[model samples]
Target chain A: MARLGRVLLLLTTCLGLLGTAGCGDDYDGLVIGVVLPMTGPQATYGEESWNGLQLAEADLRQAGTNIKFKLVLKDEKSTPQEAQTQAKTLMELEGAHVLLGSVASSNTKTIAGAAKENGTPCITPASTNDNLTTGNPWLSRICYKDSVQGGVLATFALSNGWKRAAVCVDNESDYSRGFADNFKGAFEAAGGTTHFEYFKAGNADYSNVIQGVADANPDVIFISGYYEDGGPMIKQAKARWEGKPVIGGDGLDSAEFLTLIGDAQNPIYFSTHFAPDAPDEPAVKAFAERYRERFGKEPGAMAALGYDVLFVLMDAAKRCANPKSAAELNTAIGATKNVKGITGLISLDNPDRTPNKPLVIVKVEGGAKKFHSTIKP
Target chain B: MLADVLLDGLGLGAIYAFIALGYTMVYGIIKLINFAHGEFFMVGAFVGYFALRDLGVDEVDLPQPLPILLAFLVAITLAATAAALLAVLTERLAYRPVRRAGRIAALLTAVGVSFFLQNLAVQVWGAGARAYPEPGIWLYVDDLPAKADADYKIRERVEAVVLKGDAIDTARKAALRAEGIERVYRTPDLTKEGKQGFVLLALLLWTPVLWWLVKRTRMGRAMRAVSEDADAARLMGININLIVAATFFLGAFVAGVGGVAYCATYGSVKPLTGWIPGLKAFIAAVIGGIGSIPGAIVGGLLLGVAEFAIPALLEQLGWADAKAFQDALAYVFLIIVLLVKPTGLLGKPQREKV
Candidate 1:
């Protein structure tokens, strides 16, 4: 009986070691970990992004490649600290070599640090904060940076002959601060004066800020904030400043924003990655139609960016050798070429893996988003 | 700016006061902080939403005010009744076993009950924000012109120029068009006359009804007795459980009305919509002298005013750059009130007989 118990204990110890050893295995299939805010205040956005990633994965599976892609999803709960923990767990426990993540810029910052330390390639779908890819070599994003968006809006204002602008920014969010700083720089450089007002996120009332902007009497108002506060701000601003044009960044590309404002005549414009209507690219059209069919609603730019991130990973995986290790997979992802995506042609320009993608400008007209134009990098 | 802020604050404060009544009343009797009170408020909101939206109550329009009044009455009653049943069931199933337990156990049980209800609500309603369809009567209230100049100018202009011009134009163009002279100058009044009328009617009718119930009724006397000393009241031929249930019903009824009032005013409702108001109302109750009814009213109103006024005052004082500090204004007010008058402005301090 004692000898039988010793044999059983030995067997259990061997199984545990085998399980731990599986982490370093050279697997035939490619497993990518996706960290997102699957549940919380931003759950809707996270779920939509996940849906887009699934659609892209399906497309990859049908292509009949030797590489079978596996996705390990982790919920970040929309917090930077949680994102960092999830990133570490995904890398250490889940054995994910490549990562697609994180809706918010703050989350992206932490996950980027994790990916860098682990020597894994992390791609962001919708984090537009400029600092994400500014100096990070391991981090790449499918979305346009806030600086590009800010420059695009500034150019639009300049070409339209708007001489003065006022800016309202959310001080807590990195996305808002980055966009505000870049827009201010570009607008002032283009000979336009700007009056700036800063407010905290999660605040619903914007009457005082709106009043301040109206008092300044600028030609246009640029609001750098997410859709939650952006919607109320635009609505209240319309009530106070009748016909003034309100411009914002990619955060305004949400149906919720229009629903909150309850109007299409607010002359609100935003810079986004893709538009539902543009040059009739079959890839873009198919993505939009498939997304609408699946989700029972039109997909936004964030969803498109998520779809593109998966394809970018797939293309990189196809270039790599079979039974690839983490280092080989990371190398392949770093050498990604010009791949056409819903967001435009994606190509990693720098060895640091910063993607050069197109940014499109759109306006809310008649309660629908109408495509204006696209700016190429 | 100050006037607008104050008016907004007052409207918001009224809502807080209504919700605070439930917390203070329950705590007054049981000495247990019912953390699930917020979930009750949430359930009430969903009830109102489902009634108006899914139950087709908002779609049916009758000739007189009877249909509107009936729909509102039914919805409010259903919500209030459900909330009362839930409170009682929670007490029986979760709290009864732990009734004589330590204060910490009761508090933890309250938290557990809160989580259970929130999760249950999410499962039933789905994990997304649900829209509360505004009743037809309340749909266009905010669109109403608040200023006399705007209202009178539009009305006079329509009557003098547009109506007369349209009549003349239609008469002249009748031969060209085969249709009769159709006046295209019809414009409904944009003022909030309907809402003001409803509020006045409610205040006139419900105030007297509530006053009669609380001041002149036998159940009211029993409720007051239970609130003062439940054990003594039980010993004095009063059924303590029945009195407690009645109190819950009354409190939840007020909360049901508050739910409808919130939806009517805000025009939107989310799953967690009750959270902000629930927290603020709890704070209001604490500020108003926790067990004092009138104090809850004053506390709620004061909290609302402070929410708006503190930020404005700070901004005016050139501290607008620190807008994040605005969210902490309520806590600051609560701390000051606690320091100045521990039992609240109108609350009587209790003496320990031991």
Candidate 2:
């Protein structure tokens, strides 16, 4: 009984420490901690986002604001745990006023709490996890939420009268889980039945998953994973049995995916954050052109998001009387409206803090994506 | 669903068996797990990929069986031989000196070698899954209509072919019914049926040869002697190091072939692709009596069949998402086998020297 009492006291102390921790901030005129995975499997995402951010910083400085800023770039290594540690070091050590980036949705989710804990405003340039902004006032994102994409896809399924569906989710990924959960919810609410088969990231085989889904014989299949796994899964599935029309989200957007799928004669669809061919307006085209000139390559959706989010952050910071303050920055960001982004118009009027935007649907066939239709929210 | 499960399980299991063979052979000889065996498998795959890419076999727009045969022979042999050489090199540099240096040392060295090979691969080929250059011959359609405008045209053409096949089948069925003949014929999916049959036949043909090589040959005699008592065998004029090197080379050769076959089956290769299958193969080796070659093959088939069949059966039983756990759940078979027959199904229990 004495031992138990001591253990209870220890547990209470630990909980107390946890509850009281992560609520301090030191700010300067402009010190944004830019955390991203510059080297790893997801190094491409970080590099692209960093490139856009660099261009954004250059353009913003040229635009000439009274507010001065210094961006401290840290490599997050593409893991949430790493992002959390990096966020802490940046906030507690570097004295950052705001935090930007960690392109993938899962990485974003990792740093969100760190930002809240440190009382520092965190804005992800490209992460689209649906539940990211649920209760975290200090966390706001510049991309469309995963649930919005899921909801849009759900609407498409309902309108097309595709009642039964199967999903192949990357079980290891938080990004996939959020998208799958939201999709399942929206799908069921509209009276459609959906089932999921899962595989981990880096797992190349999907014969079992395919067998399960094919046996179920769903009307359509949703692959909620990156192109690496999804691409091969589709190819192998087509080899064995006649799979239904497959659908996925932005994770399917990769040149590698097209090559892996390689002449698979299956009707496929995916909803992407942006389509280069279908620019929102003239400014989007102009921004894209400028990016091309600077980067010497076609800008990906991540690059565009990184560039736009920087400008978005500048706009929000300009609105706040004290841009250095985390609370003021958070409020101004949440209150943002009518800001035209390269992807679409950004607004945060909803209590949920999800950006109101349209999702671009593309038909992926024979290693190319053709603009199908934009699903409007 | 059950049949599909069985078929895929067997298919996947075969690859596991090939990978398991290397682990079982190395462990049997030295009582050390060659963790780097999987990396050899991975390297073998890369070898096959690069070979196909460089030979222009996948690109030369060749007519039929010629290109297919060339890819199968050239890629598989090249990959197997290269992997064998790597295995010998690893055994010499990594394992040879550590032969008497305790089991933990050898195991750690194996791990270090594994990491070195994987990172070397990553550096050479930037961390990405390369499309296994498909040699467009036989039934394998490797040409992806990659041109921006070709999407619709190729899709339409492909669809037309399918429709034409369906129409022909329907007409044949109608003719059979009118003639009062009752028989069903399937347009054989040769890619599935022929390929699996070929793999199975190749496995059967080689199993006895492997058994014979171990049981009857002079090198086999030397191997068995060294394994039993290296000092005693060395005193009796057997070259222990040479036999060990030979064993490593042979095991790695088979593993490389397995890797190449995997790429052919799946149409892509990544550095990490072989890791899970490699681990499963180790489990398979353990299940089959880790030191036994015949046991590895049997264990592979058993594991493969179970790996595919369980989740499929579970799904049919309305446990819809059960297939996701199939890979993890495969361990149940290994655990059960270990518990029931600890010496493995084909193993002769090792007696303590005391």
TM-score value, chain A, candidate 2: 0.86
Candidates' C-alpha lDDT: 0.71, 0.77
Query: Candidate 1 at B318: error in angstroms?
Result: 3.1
Distance from true position, residue B58, model 2, in Å?
5.2
Which candidate leads the pack in lDDT?
A: 2
Which numbered prediction scores highest in DockQ against the true structure? Answer: 2
Which ranges in model 1 have alpha carbons more than 4 Å from their true place? Answer: A1-28, A116-119, A134-136, A196-207, A210-217, A236-238, A322-324, B54-97, B113-216, B322-324, B350-354
User: CA lDDT of B276 in candidate 2?
Assistant: 75
Q: How accurate is candidate 2 locally (lDDT)?
A: 0.77
Per-residue CA lDDT of candidate 2, range B1-354, in tens?
566667666777788889888898888888889999999999999999888767756334455456666777898899999999999988876787777889999999899888777766765775556677665432212121222122211221232122222333455445535755442211222354356556666677777888898899999888888888888999999988899999999899999988987776776887666677788888888889889998999999999888777666776789866766776778887888899999898988989975
Give the per-residue lDDT of model 2 (tens digit) for A1-377: 43554475478679857743542344346888899987556766777788889888988888898888877888776678898888888888778889997778777877888898878888888788777888888888878888888999888877777899888887768788888989999999989999887887765557777766876788888888787788878877775547468889888876567778855767888888776667446776787688889988667777878888888888989998889888998888888897888778888667766687888898875456677888995
Q: lDDT (0-100) at residue A323 of candidate 2? A: 92
Alpha-carbon shift of residue A351 in model 1 (angstroms): 5.7
Interface RMSD of every candidate? Answer: 11.2, 12.3
Flag regions of model 2 displaced more than 4 Å. A1-32, A38-44, A54-78, A89-97, A103-105, A170-172, A198-203, A239-243, A286-298, A317-332, A348-353, B58-63, B92-101, B137-194, B234-243, B316-318
